[model samples]
Target: MTGEPILEVRGLCVDYGLGEQAVRAVTDATLTLHRGEVLGLAGESGSGKSTLAYALTRLLRAPGVITGGEVRFHGRDGSLDLLDADAAALRRVRWSRISVVFQSAMHALNPVARIDAQLTDALRAHRPELSAAQRTERAAELLRMVGISADRLRSHPHELSGGMRQRVMIAMALALDPEIVIMDEPTTALDVVTQREILTELMRLKDELGFAVVFITHDLSLLVELADTIAIMYAGRLVERGPARALFERPLHPYTAGLLDSFPPLHGARVRMEGIPGSPPALTALPPGCAFHPRCPSARERCRVDQPPTAAPAPAPAAATAAPAAADGERTAACWLIDADRETPARPARTPGSTP
Candidate 1:
């Protein structure tokens, strides 16, 4: 089980440029991650999930800038604000306290360098006291930890399979035993079998090492199986967040429900599934009030003019026989349809999809 807040983000905002040409990519996003927990961030392609992860780690590029909000890292020593941290402090925190496994392993890894060299580079930089032999031994051990044979240490990126390359990236991230691992679709382009193998290995490693994870992906089904808590993003705003089962079985937000319906169930009777109608609004020309109102099936007159604040969802009906309900204050959704005075639209019963 997870325990204690290790990371906290509040009102985080990110923009692509400056002045009149600036385009907001992320707005007023807030979430907390606990030690040994897996917090899944799920959204469509351009929903700013990657941007949020980059901003949290201070890895965003020049075109993208963090305009507001704070990220606090609670360490064994003390709490430090990531946004206000200086270069020296950030260096100390990055690999030692937090690490990242980027989206594309082939792009992230050096095509020309041997796997051993790539793995040991961080150790050499962070732990200069260790001798060359000691670093080599550590690198070999990292490979074995990720289920790769130590003999493959001499192999270059082009020599290994796609799955192996991704595993190497995971090994490198864990080189310093960081407390948090931010994975931005680490399993994106791999085959189904390979994805399952990697995910199983990752879960095992997380259990053994006790590291928290911020898993960002567009695969909601995969996250429903892997995540302890799931946060839904739409048009750069957090629309809903709750326990994985709770969110899957009873999503309070229309966008969350639409996402669940987009995937087909693995078992039982076959049924038609409809994708969310209409495209996401452009950040440069977003609709007024709620950004999702244009496509929301449950949209009301009030929803078109007033933005809904994130608040606790109303209790489920007694007849609902799904996952256990989250405790009060533990579940939140940003939709006017979930308001106490309003009647929530009845969701048609449908089977949930299984992980591919």
Candidate 2:
């Protein structure tokens, strides 16, 4: 079901450097994050996924700036433009309304402090009503919520395993009961079993808490399983966005198709992963037109010269607009293939088990 958006990003552009030398780190990223939904941000390392996430959370550093566009956070009171908010306003917004779980949970944690104190610090800052004892109790409760024993609260950050620390990070992020959780590779350092456990716990928490999630990761297979909607980025622009099922079933953008082809299917016979031929282009010196065109197998002449406007989802034979509508969602993409008319010949499809 399509619900009212809790976070809306409009024409958001993040830039680095000055004058003519400026690099567009994130270009015209526009999308909506609905309450209680998880939107996966998937792409190569330099595709601007993390940059876009930082911009929305108003966490960009000086060299990295939001050059244009708006980050709107919808609250019961109304909408807040996070881009324009001051430090004081942002302090109140962070952890209270929106919290972030950075990629490296270990680094995010303080080596000097124990888990109990760390959790209490967040609780005391946001929930000032809680006394020291209450905060400790709450911290223990939070640890329990994340499947970690409260007894471990006395242990230092280094004492806990990577997965446990990540759970603690998640607990801290959820401490103030934020409306949105911006997680950047929450399961990156964990092993497969730990990752699955954490993901399962996260899904359970999402179902229980009903907070929206902006999940950033490069793992397309995990994303397909965990995310409700998937947003694929290439270079600095989004290449595809749609319901995970719809996107995996019939990806419109060539880049999107390539990413899917790269992931080996869990249930099927193992196949060699066909990586995109080239690495992501430099943000400072991106190619003209579609940034993904360089690695895109289906690139046409138009793809190299002109950026394509996001097209509607590909129309199913039953409906004239299914494909176009799939391409066109609150989560929009920027890829030429998605906009190409039916008369244009599609590139050869590569099945998962077939040789590319």
lDDT per prediction?
0.89, 0.82
Tell me the tens digit of each residue's lDDT in model 1 across 102-221: 999989999889999999999998999999999999999999999999999999999999999999999999999999999999999999999999999999999999999999999898
Candidate 2 lDDT over residue span 260-336, tens digit each: 77755555455666766888888777788787778777777997999888756444553543344544444445665
Pick the TM-score winner: 1
Q: In model 2, state the lDDT of residue 64.
A: 88
**Model 2 spans > 4 angstroms off:** 269-272, 319-332, 339-356
Candidate 1, pairs of clashing residues: none
Instruction: Give the range of the ten consecutive residues with the poorest summed lDDT in model 2.
Output: 347-356
Q: Cα miss at 280, model 2 (Å)?
A: 0.9
TM-scores for the candidates = 0.95, 0.91
